[model samples]
Target: MNLAVFPRRGYVKDPTPIESCPAFSKALGGKVNIFIKRDDLLPGCAGGNKTRKLDFCMADALAKGADTIITCGAVQSNHCRLTLSWAVKEGLDCHLVLEERVKGSYKPEASGNNFLFKLMGVKSITVVPGGSNMMGEMEALAARLKEAGRTPYIIPGGASNPIGATGYVSCAQETLQQLFDMGLKVDHMVVPSGSAGTHAGIVVGMVGNNANIPVSGINVSRTKADQEALVRKLARETAQRVGMSGEFPDEAVTCFDGYVGPGYSLPTESMVEAVRLLAQTEGILLDPVYSGKAMAGLVDLVRSGYFAEGSNVLFLHTGGSPALYAYLDTFK
Candidate 1:
């Protein structure tokens, strides 16, 4: 697999750490050994998994001679935050199309990523209703920017396209090398599945490298069937993009939808517990939207004997802890 074919901006210089969490593991009944991939500590204004995707996406945008960027995400989106941060660093203007997934959720006075969006000097922000056609909205914004004599590039929500997904393919290779050096073998891997790029890229990297590690996605929004199919499709596309040829197996993609209690960005009791547990136990913070709920799923699965006794499970901490400020009431 030649990821060199894809242009990357080198946003992430050093590999993120893989650390053991004994206290958190014991809290889950000590049935499985828990380790975390700290993509949460990845580089950006406030680090998150999106930086990995943006490392490639931003490079693609620059390579195409874009002087401006247009992307879409839910209100208080971590993806949007990181996208804007990198654009600022790259000296490019950024525009945002935010979807109010819940009615009246977009507030100018809101904290978290929204506040950061303004502090970082986004060129403009457009809020639309829930379930809006995000790509169309971005294209419309892009048209206006083009008319203004600005070159604009559109990055889909969460940077989940083949280009962005290549970042995780590189991540998979990095991880495999790390595991080999540490003499550790992870039995399974869990990730938050939203736009599918991170999950898909990891799947391709693991399979393409013949590492034989199964990647499980904890859905932040979609159903089990839907998220699994999306990851599988993107995995195939990412593999092909990196010049790998083979059938992308369906069994490689797995997801659990039980943890999404109400819907995307809504608070759940399990999520609250999971967030607080990791913070208190390991001094690791997880965001309310994605990583919190994902940790909740992993906790439940372990408590229910989902994995074999003495198994080692790796959890990908795709960061968004900065969004925690917006959910203060939920945690309270």
Candidate 2:
């Protein structure tokens, strides 16, 4: 889809690598050949998938002549950390509205992304209760900034809007090209479904490019039905935003919620196993919240024989290993 027609801040110059994980695959009985798209290595303060979405979102903010950036995410949000990082690089003041999705989860003295927030000098940090209206909170913050003579631009949570989702459309294209270059024929793909930006963009990108890869989302928060619907809606909006025409099939967007455990950011035994398995087997670290849970889901799916024997599956590693420090107790 000609994503070049859209404005981007050019934060990502090269595509992340796609590497085989024989050991990890073997751990799952080697029923499928597994490959990982290392998006966790995307450029940012700590590296993450959000850096891609921010590339487009930040460009939009700058284009509108914004002097300050405002965004929201959960406590220890990789998105917030990356947004603040890029804002610092661009000489823009960044404010964050963090939601304690779990009650009492926001700790002022916490490590991980929270510590990075302070270390990077976020202009302000507002912690909201779980299930708070995040956009409303951001709008209020923007209004206050306006009253203070600051030009504030608000980026939605996870940058899941059409403009931000275009970053993943670009990533989808890059991944397809990489697969082609390597002569790899991936049968299925997996990603984390949270704010739905990453999952939605990949769905739209695959459709737009006529790639036959079916992307499955491992839900970190919502139920399968809700997450699938949210992702499908955003995928359609993103496709339309990128000038893609025609109906996006409802069947295209799929999600599995079996791995969310008790709730968002709550530790699960499967998540711990997945994190340790990858770290030990591949020397790769996955953050506790998103990627770890998604990997847990992937591991379960593989064990359950979700794919045909000898199939090829590609997992999108969205990255957030920095948050691992905060979950030391959980991992322990």
Go through the candidates in order and give the C-alpha RMSD of each one to the true structure.
Answer: 0.8, 0.7
Clashes of each: 0, 0
Model 1: residues with Cα > 4 Å off, grouped in runs? none
C-alpha positional error of residue 6 in candidate 2 after TM-score superposition, expressed in Å: 0.7
| Candidate 2 TM-score to native | 0.99
The Cα local distance difference test for each model comes to 0.93, 0.93
**Candidate 2, pairs of clashing residues:** none
lDDT of 2 by residue, 81-176 (tens): 999999999999999999998888888999999999999999999999998999999999999999999999999999999988898999999999
Clashing pairs in 1: none
lDDT of 1 by residue, 1-332 (tens): 88776778888899999999999999999889999999999999889899999999999899899999999999999999999999999999999999999999999989999999999999999999999999999999999889989999999999999999999999999999999999999999999999999999998999989998888899999999999889989988888889776888879889999998889999999999999999999999999999999999999999999999999999999999989999989977
TM, every model: 0.99, 0.99
**Whole-model lDDT for model 2 versus the true structure?**
0.93
Q: After superposition, how far is residue 332 of candidate 2 from its true place, in Å?
A: 1.5
Scored against the true structure, residue 283 in model 2 reaches a CA lDDT of 91
Model 2 worst lDDT window (10 residues): 241-250
